[model samples]
Target: MSGIPDNLVGLHKHVKQFREKNDETLFEELELFIEEEKVRRKLVLERPGELFFFYKEDYIVVTEELSKIPLTAEEFTGSSSLLRQLNEDQIDMVGQLTKELVILRSMRMWGSYLSC
Candidate 1:
């Protein structure tokens, strides 16, 4: 039936190709981490530095907030070089952390207002 994810191909909703490189790719990846109603799964979020996220739910919230910003190599290249090799899952986790850092670093002057 609906077991295979690729089987969703017949649906009318727009399907995006990864090649175009747009918000859809980010949203699609974000959607994969969120579980609703009948389908629940574990989410794993990683720490790139001093930040700490105790629960998996943090990934859903963090990813949504982080996606609002775009990626830049000038900000990420240094920190990302911490690892020489990353498997797919590690790449995702590290990328998420890097994005989070970029946003927070960019918002640094906002100070305590970040909580608001």
Candidate 2:
């Protein structure tokens, strides 16, 4: 999915408004924006009346007729530890790929010398 939904386009405008209005109630203002997005999701998503719920079974379940309300903050929060680990892994892989490419190029050069 895209980074941000189209309905949230007004968020930028709101930010501008907040700046103009000198509103220090940042959390409350942002909460309103989040609620608006949630309502938008209800309108745009299928089975508008339904919601996903986590049960004692250690698995999440989605049911009809709004079994539970989902918390967007909890669901959307990123694990800093997980993200850092992933970035470290990616750096290691890129280093290995670079080393392999250098070795392959050197091997080709060595073979060319031997064939001369």
Candidate 3:
């Protein structure tokens, strides 16, 4: 029942690669770094492959007539007005979880923590 962002796997790999490539130098591909970051954010904003804000519909029941059952964005695009409402902290929360999951995966200790 855990909620892992659909783009999390890519974020994990991207961050890991970015770390490995960083040389801590003045000319350390700053533009490339920025582009990578934008790509990461775009994944969330655009929600390619139905990314982020994961949910399960079968678990819910329609007790009565209502409007919004399963929540959804007004649009799924890099320039989505609704998706853009997510604040920096909210985005960072997912990023941080992705980082931690990456660490756990690297440790190969999934014997009990998680199944997926």
Instruction: State the lDDT of candidate 3 residue by residue for 19-91, as single tens digits.
Output: 6334443135444445555555565566543323211111112232221232224333332332333332243
Candidate 2 residue lDDT tens string, 1-116: 12245665445465653673444465465666566556545544755544333111122224532233232334324444433443455532212222122233355433432231
**Residues 60-86 of candidate 1: C-alpha lDDT, one tens digit per residue:** 234444443433444346434332232
Top-scoring candidate (lDDT): 2
When sorted by TM-score, best at the front, the candidate numbers are 3, 2, 1
- The regions of model 3 sitting more than 4 angstroms off are 1-24, 48-96, 100-116
Superposed on all Cα atoms, model 3 deviates from the true structure by an RMSD in Å of 16.1
**Model 2 reaches what TM-score against the true structure?**
0.21
Give RMSD to native, each candidate.
15.9, 21.3, 16.1
Whichever of 2 and 3 has more lDDT, that candidate is 2
- Per-prediction TM-score to the true structure, in the order listed: 0.20, 0.21, 0.23
Give the residue spans of candidate 1 off by over 4 A.
1-58, 63-65, 78-116
lDDT at residue 93 of model 2 (Cα atoms): 24
- Model 2 spans > 4 angstroms off: 1-23, 47-116
Error of 1 at 15 (Å): 27
